[model samples]
Target: MTELLSLSRAARLAGVTRAEIQKRIRHGEMQTFEGQVAISDLLRVYPSVSLEQSGDFERVEQIKAEAYPRSHDEDTRLPSQQVLITRIKALAEALVQRVARVEALEQLLEEVRARLDEMAADAGDKSGASAAAETQTHTQAQALRDLSAWLQTRRTDLAESAVEAAQTQLLARDSFLRIMSASVKMIPSGHEFFVDGNESILEAAVRSGLRLSYGCASGNCGECKARLVSGEVYRLREHDYVLSEREKQMGYLLTCSHTAVTDLQLEAAEAHSPADLPEQEIQAQIRKLEPQSGGLMLLHVQTPRTNTLRFMAGQRARLRLADGPEQELPIASCPCNGRNLLFTLRQGDDAFSQAVFETVTPRQPVTLTGPYGDFVLADATEPAVFIALGDGIAPIKSLIEHAVSIDSIEAFHLYWSVPAPRMHDHQPWCRALRETLDNFAFTPLVDAACDDLLALLESDLEALPDNRYYIAGPGSAVQAVVSTLLAAGVPQARIASEELD
Candidate 1:
């Protein structure tokens, strides 16, 4: 039996009005028994609800001490757009040196040719009396040919070596920081990563093998959300995701969407080693495809039992078919059934997927490489909230099934949102989950209400302050929900997010 609290006590604990509490109940965000609210549920929804939001400077300071970042503003920026400028500068220098050498050699060659002409003319006039001059002219012509061959070789070498490390300093052509002029030094832990104006901080970190939680590598997924503790930063591109006003006040920005302007002293989740999930290159066969309501196809893949893939739930892999380029898609199946894999492919203009959907048939050869992504279930036993947008439901479904199978969780809620009400085709699986699990609930947010996911969530789940939120959606929608959570004062580490294409 779950513990229950009265509406007044719940409101008091959450520091909100009774009407607000009622709204949560009506939206199914709050669970109750005979009209009484669950205390655990209240705590899960309002981790910071007990903290006085009206406190003075000292109180706010105390809260800051307990949280991640110590400050928000007071920072500097980097020299933006250094990569392009660096390349141009390198090319210009190479061209200048090459041109100078070529011009000097041409002048020298012309002088040599003119002297030989004079020697030949003198030899012709003096006949037998100037044999020595004729011999000197032949020697000069031979030397000129040698010099011309040398110049040609040298020019080829210079052009070929122009883009290599010799021209661009020690860093090679593809080096992530090769063109960067500014460096970002993180505070407290002191891990440093370099960034050019063109690359986002997240991209630079990844290239440097420093992991800051990121997904989509676009502005829409707020997974790379971090505070600018004290560095000037500039936007690389306008982000698709919306940020809450509170979040902006807190100096939160997506590492994938911003570049450091100054030598940055930053505050972010410390870069850490990724989990060791053994990776392999395997050949699999396409088994089947089932059409779903959202113009999606449930793709089934099977590999030989001897070469069964090892992957955690909620992880994705890249698939390559025949000779086409590889396409990255999430694994939509549990490891419990290790030999077979499931993935959801949205029908659209993507040539790779369309090729597989329309032309490919069963038993066709496919290649898989991965078990990438760190969006799997956390080690904690906290109740979880899953919000899925469109085909983002794939991984969430994997998580739900696997979590239950592993006894990792029982009670969890899913908010499944689609483009419209007509695309709500996942009710059967949700019903099956409810029947199987001891505690499970699925809520579909479809129709026009699904159009603005942030607004829908803000109006419905604003009271949930503490549950571990696992969100997967288009980058913009994920960012919006994350911004909403951040504005509500949820801890950053508790919000796990990934971006869907």
Candidate 2:
């Protein structure tokens, strides 16, 4: 019997990103059966894969420790008791079925061996047989006995096969993982994310950088309603929003109130374009206002718990002060944390800048609206070149964080041009990123021109022609980088840019 593993599970067992597994499949290095990889094939490709090396056991222990006293607690890292029970029941049923099948196969094998023995005994009892015929019957009987022995030996070998044992361990860990968390696959868009801990489907979706349409993070609105295409989900909390009888019969569930009981396929609304996202107005409180070098201010704000802002990474938002001033700036934080938002602001003669720098304090209420701009990442699993000139790092920062959250980007190379003071402030971050992400590289330039930037990227052009390019800064700087990339044989469709000034 061959065990087929989902792409995500195969990646986990192989200790690589899912994108890496997909890349192998695309390059003909690995094969998939019905979008799932065979465990045998996985082992053949990733020979070094081991239970310990996969870190699955450690993860199990960690999640258990994190969710200790793991009953119905919603604040912990384990699913609710009801969800856990349902998953265990499902696994138990599957196990029983497999056991029954094994027993039936054993019985069939015994019957076949008995028939072979009968045939051999009958051949030997042919007393009237000629000498030549008797010799031929004896040879046939010997061959039949040998065949039976070979079949028994083969069965024993398979029962104790090292590959089979390894796969069994992998399956055990995977089952535990499934009980702890359920993977959600979105339809139409084909987006996928894991629902870990006790997080509702909506929460997990948002944390995974998915721009699913929702009116409220709470369960009061039915905007988060999605059809359960397959798999099981249990209600973690009751919702006030009532679904129609027809909708309920058709498997509709409120994502904000339900927890997945098994891996799920959901027909949910997701935003793939700027137009897909609706304009939202949120009254957010200032959380922190810290001044950094190069006259830049880091303004942090937290939205009301029930009404978080909905936006994609690398997008801009319009911030308005009560009876003061307003400004439109690129968000500097990833969309994973919709309630908590960060913006990079340069102190300028603008009224909004002055108000934010001098008057804004913690707890100040600000009206935020219009999550604008289409400057977001496009190929989630591609190597990317990010060019940030001056304050363009703001949006670029969000893009980088979003890519990190997605956990599928093959590689990241950032080329940032800023003043000496700004570069000094950015070095620690760049160094930290390099130290953490093995595939990340950074180049900081002080007062560099288009020619210098182009020269620095020449090697990358030769090495990564498929790399997606993102340029952000002053309009002129963005234009210069775009032209340089285009002149270097990069397709225009592969390049995206945003002007910060």
Give the TM-score comparing model 1 with the true structure, all chains together: 0.44
Positional deviation of residue 474's Cα in model 2 after best superposition, in angstroms = 0.8
> Which parts of model 1 have CA positions greater than 4 angstroms off?
1-274, 447-463
Clashes of each: 16, 0
| Prediction 1 global C-alpha lDDT | 0.64
Off by over 4 Å in 2: 53-74, 127-136, 424-426, 460-464
RMSD of each: 29.4, 3.8
How far is 270's C-alpha from truth in model 2 (Å)? Answer: 1.8
CA shift of 148, model 2, Å: 1.7
lDDT (Cα atoms) of all candidates against the true structure: 0.64, 0.81
Q: Candidate 1's residue-wise lDDT over 77-108, tens digit each? A: 23444534644465566568867987998789
Worst window of 10 by summed lDDT in candidate 1: 67-76
**Native-to-model Cα distance after best TM-score fit, residue 432 in candidate 2, in Å:** 2.9
